[model samples]
Target: MKSEQGDPIPLWERSEPAVRPAPSPLSRDNIVRSAIALADSEGLSAVSLRKVASSLDAGAMRLYRYLSTKDELLDLMADAVYGEIVSEGPIVGEWRDTLRTIANRIRSACREHPWFIELLGGRPHMGPNALAMLEASFAALNDSPGFDTVDASMQAIRTVNAYVIGAVQAENSDLKNSMSKADWQKVWWPYLERLIATGNFPMLAKIIRDASHPSPDIIFDTGLETVLDGLGSQISR
Candidate 1:
């Protein structure tokens, strides 16, 4: 495949190289795996061709045979994590249930690999595994009773996906700001209390004082259900 610039397209558009006659210590899979491990442990900024190669005990230049650029490495890593998000078996039960399962899995995957969220924006992913997860979502909505057309299904997928991405991004941002629960309590909590005391933000103050703070999982589940409810209304229309 070719790009607008007429260069041979890499990443999702190209096939992996043929396996060597003799097995080698390095393969695209291992390189991507090592890079993912590094990202999971240290974050995305810490990942580089050199760093991943060092983790695999291979020279950085050797990785070029399998991956041309760090962007390609990141594409592979993101795709592999999508593979993790896929359900092990076919999604059964109602459409809402299927979508719920899919949404939760995506949220879980993002939480596990915070770096995945960083790669999620700016460009679209068309990798095999990323497409698989998307297909599952489309299929779920397509099979719904009221979602009769491809366009309707596509719109539904985008809406739910937007919610999941936005929610996870906000959740991760909050987590990053506070070093720990104790830190949040000690640092942010007082600042928030002071803001509430000013009385300019009465609604915010009310929530701060009266609302019960649920675990992140619960908050996510609640938000997911609210989004699903909105979709459910449209479907019932």
Candidate 2:
């Protein structure tokens, strides 16, 4: 299959250089690992072949031998993070419990590597690690009694995955705001109080006055349970 670069073979499908100079430390794994580390520190936009090569103390062009394009590098980086998700041991339990484990692992990986969802753009991942992850989720759902058909199982998996992607994206977006919670309350709380005093937003005013601000983890867990509950109702039919 073609990569985004239009290569006849995707980077993951290509064999590593069979004739690299002896004792050379440059390999596809090293290049991708270096790239991931760079992205982890500097953000995804900061990663490039030149920077990755320099990080590895290798020539910039040397990286081309491993991956011909930046998109390919991105594929490797994303899959590496997927490998982290897989590293969490086998997911075992009832269908709901199994899905909860899978969803939580995915959320943790994205939180650790914030650039992961960004890399998910419009391209489908074909990497082995990504495939394995999908396989595990599908298998879990397919084994469940109510998910009797492949289409039913696939729909359930997609719903859970979409919830995770959207939820993590919201969390990451909130994190982008640099203001500390104390600063936010000290500065904006007064202004928000004035807005609430207007009595135009009764529900919002009530929330501001009464709702306990839950932690992100609590919000995520609550939302996941709701999603699973909805799915459970659908499947029980």
Candidate 3:
């Protein structure tokens, strides 16, 4: 009802404003857009109705009309984040290839945002873009040879999504991830320095001495292929 600036905003707006409320000069879309920019620049912890309102020159209370709580706002934010992904490939191929493509697309979306992985599977059955992606997953299975049984198809979809979502979660983990990677590099470089210097750990040291680890993309592709291979066996039966 009331915005942080002490003005009234009804809540909800598309990317563009059709008509701006005179007093508050805000819409739901503007608030979300600004909030996204804030979150993208900062972290989700930095986002608040007050912060978004301030960015838009409105008041935080005004956001309450459409977004009752920050939780709702976050859901909206994640849904909004999903809208950014654009995957438009043919789905008529082998189910393995189809799902593989979908997983990569979703993974890349999470990778780019680095926020949606955790945002997903929370507050189930919410978020427009999230739902859309889920629907696409189910549709892919149904359109393939795995279409024999509903329960099996559902299980397969769920299993694949769990893996893809989990991959995103694993990649985006902050505290442990930072430490783990640093520790890996620490162990790797020093061990390589010594091993290469003293000629121990010959195999590992040789790979390390090659100037590049297998590379992140290579790792992702391998995991993606593994998941696809497992799925292929199920569908063929």
Q: Give each model's whole-structure lDDT.
A: 0.82, 0.84, 0.69
For lDDT, the strongest prediction is: 2
- Which of the two, 1 or 3, has more lDDT? 1
| Residue range 1-237, candidate 3, lDDT tens digits | 556797864333223335456666776667778877887777777888899989888777766655678876777777776666534543446677766777777787776666566676666745566667666666767756667777877776667778787766766664335666677777767756866787666887666657565656676678878877887787677
Ordered from best to worst lDDT, the candidate numbers read 2, 1, 3
Candidate 2 C-alpha lDDT tens digits along 1-237:
466787698567787876566435788888888988998888899999999988988789877878888888999899899898888878777888987998899898888888886975358888999999888887776677887899987787778888888898899899887688799899898988888889887998888779998999999999999999999999887
RMSD of each: 3.2, 2.9, 6.7
Q: Which predicted model would earn the best TM-score?
A: 2
Residue 3's lDDT within candidate 2 is 62
Q: For model 2, name the residue pairs that clash.
A: none
TM-score order of candidates, best first?
Answer: 2, 1, 3
User: Which residue pairs show backbone clashes in model 3?
Assistant: 2-61, 2-62, 3-59, 3-62, 4-59, 4-60, 4-61, 5-59, 13-29
Q: Which candidate, 2 or 3, has the higher lDDT? A: 2
Quote the lDDT for 114 in model 1: 92
Clash pairs for candidate 1: none
